[model samples]
Target: MLKFTQNKTPKLNFKKALKKPIPVKCVQIDEPFEVETMEGVMKGKAGDWLMIGVNDEKYVCDASIFKKTYELMK
Candidate 1:
């Protein structure tokens, strides 16, 4: 049988973890883009950029894009 014992030294430094900053990248959108939606489809206009979500899971797009797409559907 093996017995487990706690180490006298602490495992991690809390100070270092707090000082670290999360990594993120800023992307620029220069042209119109399109996205699919449950209702139908959506679009993004040129000259519009968004502070996208981490790992490209989400993003901010131009308001006009959504408006145009809705109008077209109607």
Candidate 2:
């Protein structure tokens, strides 16, 4: 019996989606805390961002990434 191997073809072009920036309520955690998210409970550390989504869902975001991704609304 002979076994054949399948070769995968790569796509030449990639599609990109435009993301709109929407504001959400977020607060910086002063101490370690746990937030109950839709997925499950998530742990947040001090200086991290605890975001409350439009649906009132809570989630944690790293401080570094948050700073880079979000800016204060003036």
Candidate 3:
């Protein structure tokens, strides 16, 4: 038998990009819906976010994740 657990911090040399900001389109949904993405068709719940990326890729993101991961482009 073998047992292992993840209790180590990442040691990979990852750095944030210092590139130009490219804005995308984002909208909030008022009802459950589905959208086509590069990955495939995905379902979203009310209050989720629909994001259209730089290359016109469309996808849905949960409201909580959208809030934590993105900001309004003002």
Candidate 4:
């Protein structure tokens, strides 16, 4: 008798939307934003995304929300 082994597909991890940081002209806060840093809650606006440091720490917010709120920094 011959036996066949079942193939299993790898599971996907969606815990984090953005695994790495991308370049953004800046984060325009139409209203206001409060971001938490390793040190504590740091705030600011304008400049590169990675440099913005808003996403440096773990966050559960959807970036698309910001995309809808803010246009390309240009």
Candidate 5:
């Protein structure tokens, strides 16, 4: 015979969670962005963000999207 167990953890409120201020780091894009050669596709600026390539290739993205993504990464 076997016994069964149940989880009683409460569900988190995501909407309320987002209300808190998130801490992030400030970084500058030092070079021209290449879209094709990037890995770990993180968020971008405006519409595009930035990515660090597996082979040391860096890219720049739109401002809005990058801000959003940068916050998440922070």
Candidate 6:
């Protein structure tokens, strides 16, 4: 029989957000960035999940969701 286990380790794609993400003054990212994780659906700005604020809020999210959700800022 084959067995499947949850990946406890963070993957490469999970490095989208840094522990200490820098805040940009006038960076406009897309909206409605959402990702389904083991916990639940995570929501944030399209290209700035690690964003500490909406023009300024201190929130936390896993890198996995951040990578999957963040869009490219133009």
Better of 1 and 5 by TM-score: 1
Give the per-residue Cα lDDT of candidate 1 at 17. Answer: 40
lDDT for every model? Answer: 0.49, 0.87, 0.90, 0.45, 0.50, 0.50
Clashes of 4: 0
Which prediction has more favorable TM-score, 2 or 6? 2
> For residues 1-74, what per-residue lDDT tens digits would candidate 1 score against the true structure?
85546765455554644423434433446888765544456665675544334555444455555344322211
lDDT of model number 5: 0.50
**Candidate 1: clashing residue pairs, number:** 0
Candidate 2 Cα outliers beyond 4 Å, as residue runs: 1-12
Instruction: State candidate 2's TM-score.
Output: 0.76
Question: Which window of 10 residues has the lowest lDDT sum in candidate 3?
Answer: 2-11
TM-score against truth, every candidate: 0.31, 0.76, 0.73, 0.25, 0.26, 0.28
lDDT for 72 (candidate 4) = 58
Which 10-residue window in model 2 sums to the lowest lDDT? 3-12
Candidates 2 and 5 compared by lDDT, better number: 2
Candidate 2 accuracy as lDDT: 0.87
Model 1 regions lying over 4 Å from their true place: 1-24, 36-41, 63-74
Candidates 5 and 6 compared by TM-score, better number: 6
In model 6, the runs with Cα more than 4 Å from the true position are: 1-50
TM-score ranking of the models: 2, 3, 1, 6, 5, 4
| lDDT of each residue in 9-52, candidate 3, tens digit only | 56668888874667889999999999989999999999999999
Q: How many residue pairs clash in each candidate?
A: 0, 0, 0, 0, 17, 4
Model 6 earns a TM-score of 0.28
Please name the candidate that would achieve the greatest lDDT relative to the true structure: 3
Evaluate residue 40 in candidate 3 and report its C-alpha lDDT on the 0 to 100 scale: 90
TM-score of 5: 0.26
Task: Give a tens-digit lDDT track for model 6, residues 1-74.
Answer: 85545865533465465555443333334565655544566676555444445445444444456567554455
